[model samples]
Target: MRIPSYEDMLAAHERIKPHIRRTPVRTSDYLNDLAGCDLYFKCENFQEPGAFKVRGAANAVFGLDDEQARKGVATHSSGNHASCLSFAAMRRGIPCNVVMPRTAPQAKKDTVARYGGRITECDPSTSSREAAFAKVQAETGGDFVHPYNDPRVIAGQGTCSREFMEQTDGLDMVVAPIGGGGMISGTCLTLSTLAPETKVIAAEPEQADDAYRSFKAGHIIADDAPKTIADGLLVPLKELTWHFVSNHVSEIYTASEQEIIDAMKLSWKHLRIVIEPSCAVPLAVILKNPDAFAGKRVGVVITGGNVDLDKLPWMQT
Candidate 1:
């Protein structure tokens, strides 16, 4: 697969602007005090589709010509990507076929279906998900929009950071939760060109820290169904995403499951905004390592808000 460049990101930004929201940037004084750093959150969760994935999905779906659009788009995602792609497809009046793990959050599955996407269930592992997606793709003949790996998707994701940079004067670091690396790759694609001095950092769950391990090993280290509260982040890095992660990402940090949950609660309590556990990983890691971010202006990507309302992780105990 080809790697997305800055130009592609610019084109993606323009293409997706009509379909996606220019999500707001929010700040929390409490969060800043707790982390000892200035925090500006790019509230992607406020998106109409409740996730940043919509930007990429809209970009990919809208970029397709009449021939490609006729058949529609297909992808495999843990949750947000599936729903967002479905929303994008719905906007363009096309079909969207999604292969998702049966174990994904019920809320996410419902969201996908609400947008008229056909769902194919699969086992939770990456291997099984891919196998199932392959069958679906072959049958549907839809344009494959790999959740994170495709160049179009990465370029689409890059728009988030471009918006972030414009909203904030500048930041010392831009931290986003890493799953398959689409959002982070997008961040890298934009910042590496747009704001070369701004560091792009990745936050991951310690339980599903394959990306971190891969970073240390200097290669892709995919996990097989690693469990974590950050369910949206269970997927591993692919070639296209690894390209940006290896080159442009400055650091990768991790937080334990409890830390993720605690941070989720903290954000809800202080920021007064709903956030998914996956999105909370950035704050979790920042709080866990305050000295690293002390006195710096940090831009945090609030990735999604599609949480299972009844099964809030913090409410379990």
Candidate 2:
């Protein structure tokens, strides 16, 4: 696969600008004191589709030609990407077919449907999701937009960090939750080019720490259906994402399930925003290792806010 260039990222920003919201960068004095650092939160949760995935989804959807757009796009996502892609397709007035894990949050499924995306549910495993997606693609002939692995998607995700840089000055580091590494890869791509002095850190749930293991192992290490409260982060790193992780990431950190839950609740309390568990991993890691970021100006990417109100993680037994 051809790696997307800095130029591609700039092009993607231009292509997706009109379609996506330039979400606000928010800061909380409470969070800053807790983490022992000045923290700037890029609020992608305020995105139209309620996630940063819309940046990539919109880029991929709008980048397509007339013929490709007619067939539409398809992908497999645990949650956010599916809804975001559906929202992008809806904006383009095209069809979007998504294969989501049967265990995906009801809120995400509802959003996907609300945006006119056709959903095909599969078992909560990478193999099962791929198998289900293959059938959907075969039937519809829609262009396949890999959630994190596609170059177009990564380039699109890069736009987030670009915007973050424009919003904040001299960020010592930027941290983002890593799943298949789409957001992190984008962060790496943007920082490596635009802000080379800034460190790029990836945060993951200890329960689903494939990227962490992969970073330590110096290669790709995938997990199969790893159970984590951060459901959006259960996916493993693909080759495209691994390239960015191995070469550009400053570090990989993991947070326990309880830590992730606490961080999620804390952000909601202080930031007055409902961020999903996946988005809390970065703050969880920061709270876990305060010394690493104590004096730094850190940018934390809040990846999404799509959660089922009836089954909040903290309220679960």
State the C-alpha lDDT per candidate.
0.94, 0.95
- lDDT tens string, model 1, 75-116? 999999999999999999999999999999999999999999
Scored against the true structure, residue 151 in model 1 reaches a CA lDDT of: 91
Instruction: Give lDDT: candidate 2, residue 160.
Output: 98
lDDT of 1: 0.94
Cα lDDT tens digits for candidate 2, 200-220: 999999999989999999989
Which window of 10 residues has the lowest lDDT sum in candidate 1?
Answer: 1-10
Candidate 1, superposed: residue stretches over 4 Å from native: none
Clashing pairs for predicted structure model 2, backbone only: none
TM-score of 1: 0.99
